[model samples]
Target: MANSIFIPLHAVPSGLNEIIDLIAFGFSDVGRSVPNVYSAKSSDADENWKDNFVFVEDVGSGERCWVSFFETTPDVTGNKEWTWLAGVTARWSWDFAGVVAYALCSYADSIVYNDSGVLTGQEEYSAKDLKGILSRD
Candidate 1:
């Protein structure tokens, strides 16, 4: 089973390219020092789904974690939004990958959406809660 969480960006800034760059920079700033942290972007048309997303993976020990982003439906006001997903493999702790996801969302001034699609305010996240969000078991 994997543990996962979804973060949604409320009002993305005007420039799309800038936001992508910001997310990449933010992830690097927080995750660069973590061992075996790697990042990639989807190249397949179907996989990308016309959204800007970066995927992060930890290629270290027995347990690994991953993070990525995807575009979601527009808000009521019709502003574009994105959902960032972070997850850890079974028995793995929320590590640098999770931190990078959080940092990317923070830099984008994003919000969180529960499984029910309700908006969650910008509140601090606990490891347990985040794991719960990512859990598939």
Candidate 2:
């Protein structure tokens, strides 16, 4: 899986709202009601992937920003179940890989935000900074 970039809904074309809503609903149960809020996509040839735009309001400035997410999967274990080794291990490994990869990418973005809220002037990310983002140490 690749890094999931955060995108604002406003940046999306007028035709893709339904796909965003669908992804949002998949992420949270509350989003289910928003299904069909918009019309169909721009064209039948558009590949609507599991990508979505998020409008995040700045806690201090109240400015809204957008981000996009990709390649997300549902976790049904509820955090307390033991592993079932009876099934194919390859599938389990792939699932875990997606989870870990997403987590690492998110951590990097968080560090980017914390170190430079808007990342206004940073031209390069140092190796040290990269590790710091990975572990937040």
Candidate 3:
């Protein structure tokens, strides 16, 4: 199973592409759909044109902690919003996922979200909040 986080972006410095540099982490494009997601239309919703899917990894030593950049088709979903569905597999990868989200929050003007692990609402984590979680030893 994988733990997931939702990064609802407001305005990235150079659109979605900026995220590649902002995170400063190692990742590779395992695969991606054709036709480019940015040019997708709302009327094309029925086709469900989901976008890029990348795999995150450690900078060196090739430590693999699979992270998927699940970008859903916004127009099809009926909301003009974008989110980084950073899904982390395995327990060890959870922290890596947090680090990725933390870096994103620091550079971007938005918050990230995930399960609170409680019975109630989701946890809307800030860069500071994720730092606290990641710093725990």
Most TM-score-accurate candidate: 3
Candidate 1 residues lying further than 4 Å off, grouped into runs, are 10-55, 59-63, 74-91, 112-137
TM-score for each prediction? 0.43, 0.23, 0.51
Model 3, 28-110: lDDT tens digits are 11111111112222342232223434344555434334334445555522336554344433344565555666665666555
RMSD list, candidates in order: 8.4, 16.0, 9.7
How much lDDT does each candidate structure score?
0.43, 0.27, 0.46
Model 1 lDDT on a 0 to 1 scale: 0.43
Q: Which of 2 and 3 is the better model by TM-score?
A: 3
On lDDT, the candidate that comes out on top is 3
Clashing pairs in 3: none
Cα misplacement distance, residue 35 of candidate 3 (Å): 29
Q: How far does residue 120 in candidate 3 sit from its true spot (Å)? A: 14
Q: Candidate 2: TM-score?
A: 0.23
Ranking by lDDT: 3, 1, 2
